[model samples]
Target: MNTFQFPMKMVKRQVYDRIAVQDQISKTELLQEMDITSSSLNRILDELVREGWISESGQGQSTGGRRPTLYRIDPTHRYILGLEISRVYSVLGLYDLQMNTIASYRWFMDEHMTPERLVDYVEERIDWMLNDYQLTWSQIIGIGIGAVGPLDREKGIILNPVYFPANGWKNVAICQMLNERTGLMAVLENGANTALIGEHWAVRDENMQHMLFVNVGAGIRSAMMSGGQLVRGAVDREGSIGQMIIQTDGERLHDQGNYGALEAFASVQALEQQVRQRMKLGMDIWEAAEDLRPEQVHFDTLITGLNQGNIFLQELFARSAGYMGIGLANIIHILLPEKVILGGALINANPSYYEQAIAVARKKVGYDDSYQPIFSKGVLQERAVAVGAAVMILQQMEL
Candidate 1:
């Protein structure tokens, strides 16, 4: 791991990861679960303790012989920086080894912001946060960015992101640029993947090996975790659930020429367009959205109108929820995940949409009593992407 340059075998790393997740474990438990000799386990544990990654907590009651010494992960030994970039706003957080946010900041993202300007903004914020928290550069393990995609992860570049307001963003080497600017290791990942990672770690559900995370915003996307590992298909496009075809003769077609795609119906951009069209047809949309111009219609404005008893917006949102239900049902039937987590501003603003979508999805799934995946809102909500990005660094560190 970049944070710790200790030479260790794969088995030792695996044992260390287990202890990190479990909080505290005994040598007896490690011996039984790790399938390694006592001498080897002791040597690994000793090396980790000497390296300040693990520490003795207390004694554990033995099943038969002498008491066993318990070990716990040292949470303050290192830190990580997580950054989440979105069209409307961006967030930065500093996290310790135990995944605690020591400091955080959020700022608006102007449509005219450039890549160089963003890097400069981030560098300034990082310095301020470090100073406020009394931390040094040596304490920071690395930086992780949860960015909007499509991305070239291996090359650390953001490749033609959709809905990005700034120009000249094509193939921007975000990670490499940040690494050079801050002199720290950096990694880049899509919003969906990072959000899933954050939720998985936050829940800490050891039994939930199979789960699905859906992000509904300006666009729709999803990520899947199966058998305790992320499912990244060829080209890392395995979970583009938004592109799933729901109808053959669907009128809505995406830029990729796909008809009846999920995003075309359920995304915030689509909702805004639909609202604008209704306004142009002499509909009294302005009665509910009195101050908003037809061209200035946004998802939040629609939600406000819905709250003001606007029937048109109510129906429009319901229809959007139904479309989301169909898409989610298709995902459940194929993946059979243990749970489906929904996130993003659209879902958060109108909770009724999530309820209606789940009701419709349950009906479509039929009477399959063997496995029923739980549907719920993301626990981390808006912070999921940034926190997940930081957790990715910890995972890479094998903590």
Candidate 2:
């Protein structure tokens, strides 16, 4: 059966989504939760099962007279492809209906990687993954890409992404290209926004109505969810917080040429650049790692230096954390989300950095107890963007 040919009715889609999230739900429970009539609910359930989207899992405990039949999304019925594209690397994964990663792969993004080349690489990898898993293309419901932007999300195009080397990549219709190659529905979204969706679904916190997700990796970006909906601004660049100026005299980031931007002071790229600059001045920044040259310095090297008692690295991280705190404080003052989730390679590599940033953020908030927000680390780690991309596709699906 075609994966996307499932029930299209809003009620039916709701039923499938509910069962997908709850894992298993009794017919009686679904009846109570959904506003449809008993006959209508039964008809929808029948259609879902007929379409291979759901199955009668088993019987549930009896409330009084008779046991109710339990329904669950068929995990093997369909699959989703999630791709996360960054300036440094890309990640791709195949996820089951329940958002479990069946398989995943990561590859570095070279400067020569143009839009066509990137699409070709992804298509090849996707074919291999499908073959390895003994799955067919028909089973793939869709493909979702989490990419750097300013994107034209509605057009499914990548528009002049900062730091991307290939000049031809500008105005690339990524979704159309992938769709043509793979014969699957494709979507493109900002990496940070996709990460936020992934975190929200993974956490499954029903009470989380407002949230802020900060990604502090090669560059800093954020996504906000207010009142259970993503706050995509008029141009869908609402969460491009990296461009927010944090200091009047801070160094400019090379990509956007935005002076004193939050990313300039807090991103992994910023940290590495600072280390490189210090090395040029004859500082022993590479003392922790033997044979590591100044030009070879990267985020991982700095993380290693910090772990090995490098005083300079420690001070650098502390200072970066302070800047991050200030940036987060500004975000809080504007958004005032109930929870702020911090994630990225740097934050995940060292929890202390996030803690330090949160400490400073709390201090900056001052005596405003009403402005308190729960600051926490992201749960999905490296897979957040990929999984979130797939989840976004799933969310848009009718079933």
Candidate 3:
């Protein structure tokens, strides 16, 4: 018989070149896109089908007669791993080729995230998760990590983050390290970008193009997406909005040499500091939030109090939402994103936060839909960063 020594790289390219254009396409259309003859394209499609990466999903509607078969990528043919590393904990997520989460692990880092220890811990967890799912290492597309910034994505090392207790993030090449340990390609990205990706994935409307995703937790940032891809600068530092000063006269900052930023005014630590100051004035938030569990101290109690008609807590959240609006208004005036999604711990606890934030923004930016983007809460909520991380891995692998 016959043996066609297929150039694997070209075949891979041809397969993805078709997949990259749309969710599905016809063999004739793909042949035109590839600038190849029908017979050659048919041969490539046959090879892809035999390899189980592409599938024939029946015929398209006939314009007159003789309908053509529609082909599409098999989403289950590959998978990607995503990791969201925070100060106190981490979450590992998995995504299939269609950019859907198959499974996840919410892990508490505790005191064990030391630079030396974290690598092995993460590796073990990845292996265990794959084993549990009965998936092989070869099926993994890649790994994507989203962590607190300012991160060195090129070096794959986390620098000094505001929340964690560390001398400084050491020379930790997380991607390279993970690749060495697990034998898979890995990529690293900022946590805010992951949040943006999560918001992007949740959009049901394809026409709404531009978006600014704000990750409002212990720190604040805005990740921008334009024309369906992240808008990174020439150096890739596009969305580090935490350092944009909103206050004229604020207190001194850490030894990091930054001051009077939105992070200072609106971070979780700032809210905690306010609570401590209120405590000095004999305002017992503990008694006010008496029904709250210890595990739910991270602003759920405040949200509860607000929901239960506690005027004091309502005022606090309202004020925070107001400040958030102030920041977002600035973003709207500049970027004019079609939508803005609010994520992180504090904001997601109450749906009212979006209302309050929009209320404040309306006063500042106005309510005209003609020039304004739709405002909404992040659909992925707290899992956004983790989910984005997983998706990032998949995207990098072009799965």
Candidate with top lDDT is 2
**RMSD for each of the candidates:** 3.2, 3.3, 4.4
TM-score of each: 0.90, 0.92, 0.83
Candidates in descending TM-score order:
2, 1, 3
Q: On a 0 to 1 TM-score scale, where does candidate 2 land against the true structure?
A: 0.92
lDDT scores in order = 0.83, 0.85, 0.71
Q: Can you write out model 3's per-residue Cα lDDT over 177-218, one digit (the tens) per residue? A: 787888888788888898788668766346557888887776
Model 1 vs. true fold: TM: 0.90
- Judging by lDDT, tell me the better candidate of 1 and 2: 2
Per-residue C-alpha lDDT of model 2 across residues 108-208, encoded as one tens digit per residue: 77667888999899999988998899999989999999998879998999887766545576888999999999899999999999999998888784668
Candidate 1's residue-wise lDDT over 77-169, tens digit each?
Answer: 889999998765688999998888888888766566778989999999899988897889988999989888888898999888666667767
User: What's model 1's overall lDDT?
Assistant: 0.83
Question: Which of candidates 1 and 3 reaches a greater lDDT?
Answer: 1
Query: How many residue pairs collide in each prediction?
Result: 0, 0, 0
